[model samples]
Target: MAEPTTSSRRPGPGAGSPAVTTPALERTRRRFLRRQRARRWLAWRVVLATVVGLAGVVGACWLLFFSQFLSVAGVEVRGTSHLSPEEVVAVAGIPTGEPLARIDLDRVESRVGSLAAVRSVAVSRAWPDEILVEVEERVAIAVVELGGRLRGMDADGVVFRDFAQPPRALPRITTDTVTRREALTEGARVIAALPGSISRSVDHVEVRTVDQISLVLGDGRRVEWGSAEQSGIKARVLPALLQREARTYDVSVPGQPTTK
Candidate 1:
């Protein structure tokens, strides 16, 4: 009976023990996997949504950035003295309803400056639908009669108008009848280089040579300014010299003032 009392039991470790993962553990692992998969899916959704939003923004910008929704509708003129708006517009070459992207300010300014009346030019954009053009006209200082044509000269070495009939108010420039641009340029400089006081007091200027500049004042006095150089020094001494000196004074030499 004692021999037959031994049971069929095996070892200490049991298969159903909680030492290793089983069906219940597998169920817990499945739940964990499901949660991880849900997180991965959410991350993908976020990535996709961001990509879609960026694509939409780029598409909208591409569709609208330069679609020509607005064009040049008007023109504005400023700082103009002699040239008319129509004349400036004609030189600008900006057609009505032109796309703003096509308007080149440099080209427009260059074209406009070709006009004889325009001494200087500044062109700019006036917002999305307008253009602003500023022009400075040649200030007429004298008219030179040459070869049966009266040629106008400004104070800035620029000769512009040629008149068959001279204007009444224009001062007469009686010098060599040479109509070359260089000569005219010299005439313009002669007119333009005078100081405000000298210009106001003087009636006419004669440029006989490069350095021989003579001016006739309002009171019938003569001024023989040698050249346009040392203008500041000459100007400084002019008031005192004219006060003490005779009817004629020459201040072309900066350090020396000669009176006649």
Candidate 2:
């Protein structure tokens, strides 16, 4: 009280410490702020990149799938023999100017396969502007008369194309009715098993039943082929037996072949 209390309220920290601030501390604070800013910038950059990438992929898909750059322009046929390419293309009915990716390959195959001459078929896009159709045509191994018309028969016993007259090159398949598929199958097998020389000389194949089969040669010679069994042996034995002058040769028992 005598010295007027000398204003002893101890100076505040800022007044006494002269507002001390170290360069190192300032630098550390600045570094921390920089790191936060950097993290935000990096996050923003990653988001932008992801959006751009997605846009690019979507744009590419649109161009390839939806655009007309890859549309079909024409249909091409391959491995066609009896049926013309135009015929196959007509049957396929592939819509021109449609996107290649949009074409249904299975549907095209089924349509082309329905042709009687087609044994097997494949359909595919030939890229750029074409659809390719490949087919295997049925080959006639024998001919059968059905409804007063001669039809070509394949090895599988399928009676396909009808003919005005039986081709001289193919063996005639004589069955009670063309609907007798089993007998026709057996008769086909008998004809298929014959040696080339014998096949060329054969005139007709007679099928009374599945097992009962016979061959009439071009020279009026008859071969009594009881069944398809032992056919390979019979084929081998027949030529040897034919060397002898005989009107009828029984190769049913190939081991004991007899000539009449």
Candidate 3:
């Protein structure tokens, strides 16, 4: 009875651990080694790429900042009619042989804009070696005599270039020396409101004060236009009123025009 009890159990598939072959273990080891080598290779590639990229950035910075290859060689002026290129270049003061990127474009524009004729100026780098200055010159819409010389006046009433001889077509404006500057602006405002039909007949404007302004016609006729106020209404009424033969036309009061 004791001998039979010892041998009653039988081994099943789950009774013991499964056997592993040497070939399978070797294959796993090879796979692990291959995975480790691949990870190391990827890491090296990333480091090498980062270093190369940094070196490229540093080289480009050196070329842009320190090398003479991108330095300014000269200044080119454009959009100038009354001002010479040399004049603009001199005023710009862009240092030659300096790095193009280092040139202060805003400073150059400021200096060039100081010229009386320059309305606006733009400065930029002409890549590789030059500075470009673009200027917009003021165009005169009227003329004023100062210091016995006829000076051009723009729509803004800024007295700019001096004419060698008077421009026959341009309307002349006379102002008192004590308040010449202010008077010129008022006169310009008055002229700006007049229609082409009326403006063509105007020979000159006389300003005694800011509000006291008159227009004299080519045929010795006169228009009593007081100040620049209500000029648009006055301009509209003047052409039709001029049809009446009169020595003087008064449109100072647009609603109640008068003639003599």
Pick the lDDT winner.
3
Better of 1 and 2 by lDDT: 2
What order do candidates take by TM-score, descending?
Answer: 3, 2, 1
lDDT ranking, high to low: 3, 2, 1
Q: Write the per-residue lDDT of candidate 2 for residues 1-260, one digit (tens) a residue.
A: 47655665867777456766899999999999999999999999999999999999998777657889988899989998778899999999998888888899999999998998999998988888799998999999999887788999887777778888778899998877533668888787788788899999999988888777889999999999977777899999999899999999999888999999
lDDT of 2: 0.87
Q: 1-260, model 1: which lDDT tens digit per residue? A: 35657778866678765576789999999999999999999999999999999999987665444445557888898877667898888878897777665688899999999999888899998877889999988877778766667888777666687877766555566566543555555656655665666667766667676677777777888777766666667777777888865888888785888888
State residue 49's C-alpha deviation in candidate 2, in Å.
Answer: 5.5
Alpha carbon deviation, residue 206, candidate 3 (Å): 1.1
| Model 3 regions lying over 4 Å from their true place | 1-31
What lDDT, from 0 to 1, does candidate 1 have?
A: 0.75
Q: Worst ten-residue run, lDDT, model 2?
A: 1-10
| Each prediction's whole-model lDDT (CA) | 0.75, 0.87, 0.88
Q: In model 1, which runs have C-alpha deviations exceeding 4 angstroms?
A: 1-68, 141-152, 161-172, 178-187, 243-248
Q: For residues 1-260, what per-residue lDDT tens digits would candidate 3 score against the true structure?
A: 56655667766668495765799899999999999999999999999999999999999898888899999999889999988999888888888999998888888889999999999999998998998888999988778888899999887778889999778778888877776677778888898787888888889988887788999999999999988999989999999999999999999889999999
Residue 238 lDDT in candidate 2: 92
